[model samples]
Target chain A: MTLLHSRRQKEIRKRLEGMRPRLYRVAFAWTHNRSLAEDLTQDTLVKALQAARQLRELESLDAWLFRIMSNCRRDHFRNQVSTENVDNYDLVDERTPETRSSEQQLIQKVRDSVEALPETHRQTLTLVDIEGFSYMETASILEIPVGTVMSRLSRARARLRKLLATQHVDVRGNDSNARLRRIK
Target chain B: MTEMEHITEEMLNAFIDQELADNDMMHVYLAMSKDPDLRDRVCELRANKELLRAAYRQVPAPRKYQRPPGLLPRTAMAAGIMSLGVGALLGWYAHSFSQSDNPPRTVARAYQTFDSKVKVVFHVSRNDAAAFAQILDEAEALVAAEDDKRSNNSVRIVANGDGLFLLSAKASPFKDRIRILSEKYNNLVFAGCSQTQKRLQRERGLSVDLLPQVSTVNSGVFEVLRLQEAGWKYIPI
Candidate 1:
């Protein structure tokens, strides 16, 4: 029995191992803090392994792992919100170099826009667009209805467009070339 | 276009995502063909989705974590200390178990049965013996690890195109490993594409004999796609 139990754990580890990158990506996208993302991913993995026996089917593992991650992230925020002021997280450093290229600036601007979105919308966008999950898949991962996923995704994209416009990056994540356009 | 309601953002979003019903999808397509404004909106949405995907796809996966292979090994201790340690361990275990049972904050689906069976489909388009060997190694590792978790496991290596060469009895250098893997893992399978075989016959007038362990499939690409639709993770090698 001991040998058999150990064998089962090895298998669980392998399956979870393949998902590390994807889990980290989702975690990093959410937290925008590499260390926290790593921590979250690690914790999620541990919890998933402990609960592996409860998993009834292999097909649901992706969504199951993601759901655990989603909860882990939320719990982290709840603990963080009570002790720290998360409002100042957006304060930018004024000492940044001026030699940054327009491309870098546009990338930064897009990142900021995505990071500023409401948590639900950001997650929806990340899972659907970045992760290439279908609407139903995203819904399953987020534990929301398909309609909610659609609305959140739509709103997130619209918000990103508006936010990027303010930073002078066009909706497509490029520098605005409107000034170069010939006036018709 | 003139008779219908103006396209709402939701409708346009749905169209962009290809989530619309067939009639509605056609309606949007027809509208875009005639209305440049509608076309531009779709373009904007497409561009936005593209930009988002490009930005996030670059984030690398986490460094591979090295976890202990199993529970910590039992240690030797004095009898009194051992008794004390056992009690503490039991208490800690109970606490952790209860904590884990808390209603998960996110929406969770019913436990699925896939836990009992892991389905993997390897798409092999090359005949590299070295690469195929690596695949077998990975599969072996998976089977070993899964021994405790599921009662059954499935790993399929679908060879097509030039990849069929890896399974060819006449040319494969790793024939010994392939045979060994087949003998060891009853759940593992090697599949050769019949379509590729037919093409080879027609184009080169060559007939290939696959290892006896390999089964023939109608089409490699079709098999991969079908397996993906069936929820098997597709690993392209």
Candidate 2:
């Protein structure tokens, strides 16, 4: 039993080492700060090492790690509010000037659209739309019923549609290309 | 791109992941046949998701791990050294606070105003000096760019419990930067919990320096609740 436990621990470490880079990236995306993401990743690894014994046999390691990562992020965010005095920093990708401008506009539009959503709707969309969590997984993570997730997601999508439609109308301004783009 | 008229983001996600139930799949197909706008929105959302995923696919893991002290098996000599150092730093910072004229109320008010403008909280629990330093740098950069109009715009850094380690002089990860930021941004306040300090002193003999900008509070959790009551926005970074 001791030998088996030791072997399992070794395997977990190896698997964790392999997944570190990817986990860090997700953390980075969540926090938009390299250092915080790095810290979160390390903390996740350390906790994973400690609580590894509790992971049941049926759970996928990847999913389990992701759950840990999400919890770490939430905890970090909660602590950040209590400990550090700083503003929410958004991650802006740098591309070509034209591309950057367009992307920025799109991102701003999307952010505004998302921000307008109620907290529940926003979380559902963010997890499903932005973070790529499945309906079932998001439900589990959020500790809500699945039907609620679907309903919130549906409302979120409808709100986004309205926002996009409004933006399209404002941008067209009767220009042929703009109008064509809007219609298309 | 025009073919986008037949898909919804939810439908596309479902289709891609093969998660749509039989009834939902039929509904999606029927909806696609009837509504182009739904399809376009889904396409746009799908494209955005793909772009975001591609942009942030690789998360970096730390190459070198610095184990925190609690995790390490302590030698008597190492423990003694840490204890002595902690004692001295704590005494020094406490003395400095006693000598200073800026009362707690003034500091609290300044912090309150900062919270009104742009409240940010930093969470640090790791003993890694480099990592802690980087967190301070990020906070410094953000505070530097903050607007001057918001006099109440404050950053209260509450380091409590294990997080108080960041304030230690010997192991203080962000001492220099914390000092600089606290000075420049009067709105920036660094605080460690008194309880944690006592624990550090009694158990580990480690003393945390409470620099002019850094102060010791009764409890970290209490500080969080107070600032939150004062309407400071919270983020755990």
Candidate 3:
């Protein structure tokens, strides 16, 4: 390979490394496990780098990277046990809390509510609301219709609204259907 | 009031998400001004987006991850190389400088190959929707071909392995089509492999929920074998 080609590949690798944190956040939100999310991020990066030469348009790099992460997560679920054992996790807090602020508590509450969503809705919600992907981009990543993406996003937000309202439903996951706080 | 009542939750969602065009945006904006409940709903939806964005903004740092430093193996590259070798092998296998083995026949002179063998068992072992759709098409044609003759033609689609996905309620895209076809045809059957379902439940912990129209066989492979033994044509997709 030419020196110029080699330099381009190196630049691509650097950008992919930068995507690690974002990928980890989404993976963690979906899996609610630290090691699993980290492993998924690593797997996505490895796959992306192995086939780095196939990246034709530089602008689509973010979408392309995310699409890989989505596939990796799907493969993990397919290989893992059923969805019944999903949110029944141990809330292992890895970080020392500086302050028990109400903001932090609210954030935790929001995370819990998101965890209660169906897998498809959760994915759509995070990709659009959290990751800031366009509706069309999200539809392409999920391999569903744009209409499906909108509907899933709508459902996810509605559920979050109800859960956060604290008026309509006592639907917050109990101690048993617990979660994992942060994966370090 | 009429416009406010006409505005749907989806429209409100679209307005908050900034997915609507300018005209629709203006409509929502005016409606929100006139309706306190609509305004509160919009605020709540927007709050959900903000909370979600904030909650995930700071994630835990990934554990020290480092791969042993080299160019990783690319499956696509390997596949490309393998395809070239397979093409060369195929060319050598079918290579013929002279051609005089079988006599060419016209369409008019073509004869029936499977005479009175109207029963067909489609054997599938992959998670392919297109292949499943094709199987249904071919089965329909065969079943319809002898309707005038009132022959005892039948088709059984035996799914196993990953092919059980074709019959899954949550995953399959053709649930409605499968339901309609099952309702329309009396001699058609959609059989799921029981062993595969059990394996999926046991290994993956998935409670496999198939469509109501599908029935379970002991094993799809064995079912195909049995059907073939009983003079049914074995077709794999």
Q: TM-score for the second chain in candidate 3?
A: 0.51
Q: Across residues A107-126, which tens digit of lDDT does each residue of candidate 3 receive? A: 67777788888999999999
lDDT of 1 by residue, B1-237 (tens): 441247767777778788789998988888888887777778888877876775676663332332335633232113323432332232223223324545322100111323546666767877766657756765665554544665366778899889999999998887888899899888788999887887788789989889998999866765665575455655555
lDDT (CA) per prediction: 0.68, 0.56, 0.68
Better of 1 and 3 by DockQ: 3
Task: Provide DockQ values for all models, in the order shown.
Answer: 0.15, 0.09, 0.20
**Please, what are the lDDT tens digits per residue for candidate 2 over residues B163-212?**
77777666665667777777788767788777667667877987766655
Clashing pairs in 3: none
Quote each prediction's TM-score: 0.52, 0.46, 0.53
* Model 2 interface Cα RMSD in Å: 11.6
Model 3's CAPRI class is incorrect
For each candidate, what is chain B's TM-score?
0.50, 0.45, 0.51
Candidate 3 segments exceeding 4 Å error: A2-4, A82-99, A167-184, B65-237
How do the residues A1-184 of candidate 2 rate in per-residue lDDT, one tens digit apiece? 2322366655765676567666676665555455566666656764564456677752467667767867776765655544563423424544466664543555545455555667557656666754677888878766789777776776676676577566552332332323223321
Off by over 4 Å in 1: A2-10, A85-99, A171-184, B1-5, B60-237
